[model samples]
Target: MSESVVSGLTDLLQRMRQAQREQPHPDASLRRIRLDALAALLRENRPAICEAIDADFGGRPAEETDLLELFPSLQALAHARRHLRRWMKPKRHLAGLWFLPARTLLVPRPLGVVGIIVPWNYPLFLAVGPLVDALAAGNRALVKMSEYTPRFSALFGQLVERYFPQGEVRVVNGDAGVARAFSALPFDHLLFTGSTDVGRHVMRAAAANLTPVTLELGGKSPAIIGPGARFESAVERIVYGKCVNAGQTCIAPDYVLLPRGREADFIATAQRVVARMYPQLATGGQYASIIDDAKHARLIRLRDEAVAGGAQAHALAASSPADAGRVLPPTVLTDTPEDAAVMDEEIFGPLLPLVPYDTLDEALAYVAARPHPLALYLFDNDSAVQRRVEQSQAAGGMCINDTLYHVAQHHLPFGGVGASGLGAYHGEAGFRTFSKMLPVFRQARLNGVGLLNPPYGARFRRMLDLLLRR
Candidate 1:
């Protein structure tokens, strides 16, 4: 919070910028070295990282951190290491007849120093995920870790400093004021992963510098249970998706849309799955706690407001009592009024609302009426039903019969649209996002372009006609 600390952000950026100027384009070997160091950092400090996140969250099981965060972070490095050579290579393009004897190729160039703002929900993965892309693209990076998870953020900063050279990768940790200072820096490119409201501010600040930004924001992502869906299977998957991280995931299914009469069945299956997954319920180490008291209170307010509006609450983890840790039990609500806050806002917690529909088209229409979501889930085996939703709807990504799995596909572009967010970054999409694919054209020594360039003559007119026709 000190003035010196805030100014240090500009210092970190300037150092990275100076280093980038010294070596604008790093070779594949150097990029691989960065990947190796990052991998080693994750591999060696698994226990410490898990412990830090657990402390930050109050009590998140180590296995969940390993599966959801650590494993993905390391996997991203390996994937980048394996493909960086090819990704860095220039892509050849065929010359068109209009420009015969000329060749074209797209050369991927790094976008200098990148600024990444990481969110608290999945701090480790979000930090490393974008860093992988920036490093692979041969750019130095400055990362901002969320203040909400101070323990993990500090530990991560320490680990990064130990693994990377001073200017290659720097991690900044501070409160909102510090974050504002960090974002205000004139980074070459910026990527942020967080809520939509904050994403807007990040974009506005970046606009001052005309710095390109990639906003991975979140909205009310939904899951639709098609008429042809294996009802029980759909419930099980939805339960897993919502319950993972105790529904703290950005891409978690916010609510369920199902056929009107099947509400009881969905609730039955979901409760059963939750009980099976968490076994001990409230105090189980398998489940996670709400990030903090404020988030917990917000979720409680949403639930209270819904119930006051005539909704019925069903406790998925009803068997066990509340634990000392701030863990919120998985919950489902029914009969909530259409305009309730729960129905409108992004529910980044364990409370799942049921939005019943008479027909598949009704469900689709309901989703379309709202802001486009970061992710859409459809549970159906019928090809027609699948195609109908896939083609007619808009989402950052779609999972035919699963939830939260689309993000695991490193090959696919992971991002949102409309109110959900602004851009994508994952694997190749990420590589391109952090780079500029410059189109290089090489003309033959004896080309005829000169012939078409004259003082508005008859030959020029003829060539213009031919060009227009082609």
Candidate 2:
């Protein structure tokens, strides 16, 4: 960490903190304005934002960016804007029997200053998604953009300064060294979205300040094809999830669990789906290239290691060469060893591995044994199987008969569990995550009795007896 980076971040954080102290809680109207500005920021610079991300990724379609990244961000902002009053209004609770003449309510108070550490994969969405919550909670924020997406990160830093006022929010652009220093700042709350390994470092750094963290870390999220799953439909959904963003998405299915006898069906179906979705991985606009050469090489190494360990690699889009355009064709690996790097690590690329299971119990056992994943996909239409699997297997979020759609739901809170990540933030969940919900109790002028005083007399004894009896 450079002294300049540390000093700069410290200075900025101090300014934001002082600004938050001035107005601990912004009114609903002010929050509405902030939300509108965020939406406008996206709308006004949609093309530039998309282009920067595309350039950073080498080749990511702008339309895909609109649908996947822009849509959810805008929709979530609208949701917050529409429901800001209801969310901000203090929630009342009935007084307990012991305190009959008192009132209890939960008043959400801003946590002062918030820190959002954005990842490169979905820089725009990740940054704005949490910013929506922090602003709605009426807290000033300082965001740390990922170094991997330099083009978009720098652009966002400049664009945000133009839209938002000085102290309300500021986007900081820096590399890993700067990120290390930024994480150490004493913000009231910090939300980090990235790998589990890096999450540990962030948490440790934030620990010095005792900052509350909401970590959206991605682990090996699994997709299980249940015995009664809608066969073709399930494969189609999983293919789309894995191939989108060239499988760079955090919640994209890391691997698939299928019945031992159905490997061929999955391969055939996946091939047809991939070919249809991206007719020419060689030149197709819908098909996204790998984020960069290093990521591309890493995916190949994972695949090659899996194959060397006795797995069979079946290229879904055999006609279109992956290396030709930095676009890795969707490849499904079967007979993958338990210790293969692809299976062991979170595969954040266009490599899909299928694990065969003899029974549902075995499949559930397999998933249960591993670290809790960020997301889980179940392709079962049977209500009983869905309930059993979902109940037994613990994941941050889940999608039934589909994939990746769960994260897009504004109604649902999205986050990970255990190793995958910690805490959640989206919509109302996001609002609450960034708030400190202060508990307030008011006593009526005329209460029950002043019998239970420090003086231990007959009346105090009697009052205590009555209370104990009740």
Candidate 3:
């Protein structure tokens, strides 16, 4: 790491902190200005944004940029902009019995400067989601775009610079070495979106500075298909979520838990549905690549391991040799062992392994023993079964009949618990993550409660002890 590079970014932060103290509390007008600027930047720079992401991914689909990345970001910004003023208002809190005479209010205050670390998968949404939170909380922020997406990093930096002042918001770009330096900075709050292993490193780094962190980490999320589920609908929803972005989505169904006798039916339906969704396996412009060759190879290795372990593996759609540019077929593996490599790790690709259980209780037990997942999808029409699963299992979020769509609602708070990750941000949840609830107390000018101010007489002490005890 270059000393000069570290020094330059550090100095920028120091100046921003000083400015925050010197400036007055941002009024509603300044908050609106900040959010409006971001909205305009996102709307006007859509083309450059798409191009940069496409360049980074070796020709990512343009519609995906529009539909998945840009559209959701724009909607999030709009939602935040509409509610920013209300969210910034000071909230009134009730005083307890002992403090009934005094009035209390919680003033939401920004923590000066915030740091957001973006991930390679879904870079735009990940970056903008936290950015909206920081802005809505009335704080200046610095964004560190992922180095894996170099083109998006460079282009995002330029767009941010054009829309925001260097002191207000700046995008920093570098390799992993630079990322380490960035995480080490003492930001007031830091939000990271990435793999679970990297999340631990970020949390440890933030701990040194006593910085608050919100980690949106990914684990082996599961989708369970009960015996009573509508097979066709379940297949359609699962395939749609998993096949999107070549299954690079953090919330994509990692593997599945199916009833013992239903594995064959599920696999057969999945094959038909996936084929319908992606007519051309390799060259279809609607189909996305596996991000990079390394990810492609990793999925292949997992497939090989599962097959060698006696799991039934099938690549339903066969692709031509010439069209193999980081493309993996939508695959379904059945009867995988609990200890197999596919079950042990997060399958962040289009490989869906089916682990069959004789009973639903067994499936719940298996998921409970594993690390808490970011999301869980259960396909069952039985209310009793859904309630039992909800009460027994712990996850960041759960969808009743679908996969990954829980994160899309924008009305619910999204985050992981335990090892999946910590903290949450989306809609109002984002505003709260960035703002501190500073409680203020107001008291009457009368000195009615000053009996023991200076002289601690026996009478005063006795009264205090009796009152506290009672």
Q: What TM-score do all the candidates reach, one by one?
A: 0.98, 0.98, 0.95
Q: Could you arrange the candidates by TM-score from highest to lowest?
A: 2, 1, 3
CA lDDT of every candidate: 0.91, 0.91, 0.84
lDDT of 2 by residue, 1-470 (tens): 66877898899999988888888889999999989999999999999999999999888999889988999999999989988999999988768988878889999999999999999899899999999998999988899999999999999999999999999999888778888988999999999999899999999999998999999999999999999998999999999999888899999999999999999999999999988888877676677888877888888899999999999999998645544668788899998988899889999988899999999999999999999999999999899999898779899999998999998888799999999999999999999999999999988888874655577988888788988997
TM-score of 1: 0.98
Q: Which one wins by lDDT: 1 or 3?
A: 1
Clashing pairs in 3: none
Ten-residue segment with the worst summed lDDT in candidate 3? 444-453
Please state the error at residue 166 of candidate 1 in Å.
1.2
Q: Which of the predicted structures, 1 or 3, would earn the higher TM-score when compared with the native?
A: 1
**lDDT accuracy of residue 84 in candidate 2:** 90
